[model samples]
Target: MAVRDPAIDHLLELLAPLGAATARRMFGGWGVYLDGEIVVLFARGVAYAKTDALTRADFAAAGSAPFVFESRGRTVETSYWSLPEAALDSSEALRPWAQLALAAARRKPVARKARSGEDRRG
Candidate 1:
C-alpha cells in the first residue's frame, strides 16, 4: 500500500457521509474517488471538486474559482473548482456541493476505443 497523506485522510473522513470515498496520492496531491469515480482532489490543504459547464455556475455564484496551474510556463485551468470556504469547515455544508460535483463528474464523456479493422492505416 502507498503512504497516505494525513491531510487527505482527514478530509476523506469528513466527507464520509457522502459515501465510500477513497484517496490516493498522485503527483504530490491526492485524488478522492467515490463510487468508482473521481469527484474531488486534495492539494495544498484545499479540496477541489469536479465541475462541468452545467455545474460551474453554482461554484461561480458561490465565489469559488476553478483550479489553475502553471505548466510549461502556461497557465492551465481545469474543470475542478475549490470548495467554498464555509463548506471546508463542515461536512454538513459540503454534502450538497459534493453531490453536485459527483453529478458533474459523471457527466464527463467516457473514452471509447475504435473497433477492430475499423481504422485506416493512414
Candidate 2:
C-alpha cells in the first residue's frame, strides 16, 4: 500500500470548507483541485496557492513567496505562492486565501493563437 503523505492530508482538511478538493500525484508532489480547477500545489512540504494580478499583492503583503523551479538551467517562477504562515493555522484561517486561489483558478484563461497547420475553424 502506498503511504499517504501527512502534508497532503493536512492540506485537504484545511481545504474542506472550500469544496470537495482532491489531490493527484504530480511533479514529485501533489496538485490540489477544487471543482475541477487546480487551486493549490504541494511541493517539498510547502503549499502554494494560485495567484493572479488581483491577489498577488495580497500574498506579497502577507510575505508569501512564489513557487520557483529550475528548468534547463533557467529559473521558472509560477503563479502560485506559498500559503501565509497565518493561513496554516486552520481552515478558517485558510479560507480567505483559499478563496482567492479558487477565484484565480476560475478566471478565464487567455486565448492562444493556433499553431501552424492547426485548425482554427470552429
Candidate 3:
C-alpha cells in the first residue's frame, strides 16, 4: 500500500501539467515521465531527475543535495534533486528545472543487459 502525505500531493499537483506523458504510482510515490521516459521521481515531496556530471554541477550551483538513495558513511548521489530552495520560494523558478528534467527524459533510455532469453549468467 502507498503511504499518503499532503506535501507529496501538492508536488503531484505541481507536476500534473505533464501527467499525460507518463507517470506511475509506486514506492509510495509517483514516477514522472517525459515523452514516455522516466526523468524524475516525485517522492516525499522532492524531485529526483535524470542525473549526470553536468546535471550534478547544475544542482550544486542551485544549492541542494542530489536525491541520494544510499549513504553508508559516504554520500552516494542519485539522479534525484530536491526542488531548489530558492525555486521553492518562487513558483516561477520551479518550472525551468522541471523542464530540464523533462527534456532529459525525452532522450532514448539506455538498454541494459539481455532483453529476455539472451542471457543466463552475469
Candidate 4:
C-alpha cells in the first residue's frame, strides 16, 4: 500500500466536524476525500482545494494559484486550487473554504455497479 501524505493528514485534521475526510492514492498522488468524494489533492508539496467560488476567492487572497501539471507536453488542471499558508495558519480560516469544496465534491463520486448489471444511478 502507498503511504498517505503528511499534508493530507494536516488538511484532514483542519477539516474535521464537517464530514468524513481522508487521503487516497490516485495517479501517483494524494486525493482528499470528503463524505466519500474527492475534494482536493496534496501533490508536490502543495495543498489544493476543490475549484469553486469561495475556495477560489480564498486561494486568490492567499496568493495561491491552481494546480497546473505538465503531462505529455500539455498542461492539465484538476478540480483543485492552491491553499494559502494564512488559511492553514488561521484556526477557522480553512473551514469555510473546505466546506465549500466538500459541498462541490460531494456532487461527484464513483460507486460500484450492481452485480446484476443494473446501473445504480446516484
TM-scores of all predicted structures: 0.86, 0.88, 0.63, 0.73
In angstroms, the error of model 3 at 39 is: 3.4
lDDT of 1 at 117: 80
Give lDDT tens digits, candidate 2, residues 40-122: 99898999999999999999999999999999999999999999978988999999999999999889596798899998789
lDDT of each: 0.85, 0.91, 0.63, 0.74
For model 3, the superposed segments whose C-alpha errors exceed 4 Å read 1-3, 18-23, 71-75, 89-91, 112-122
Q: Write the per-residue lDDT of candidate 1 for residues 1-122, one digit (tens) a residue.
A: 77777767776877888888888777678899877789887777778999999999999999988888899999999999999988867788888888998899898999878788887565
- lDDT of each residue in 1-122, candidate 4, tens digit only: 76666677787887666678777777677887877777778778877888765356666776878888899999997668887676676539887777767776665455755788677776
**Models sorted by TM-score, best on top:** 2, 1, 4, 3
The CA root-mean-square deviation of candidate 4, after full C-alpha superposition on the true structure, stands at 4.5
Error of 2 at 87 (Å): 0.7
For residues 12-45, could you state the per-residue lDDT of candidate 3 as single tens digits?
A: 5565564544467877677766556676677766
Rate residue 13 of model 4 by lDDT: 85
Candidate 3: C-alpha lDDT = 0.63
In TM-score terms, candidate 3 sits at 0.63
lDDT, candidate 1, residue 1?
Answer: 75
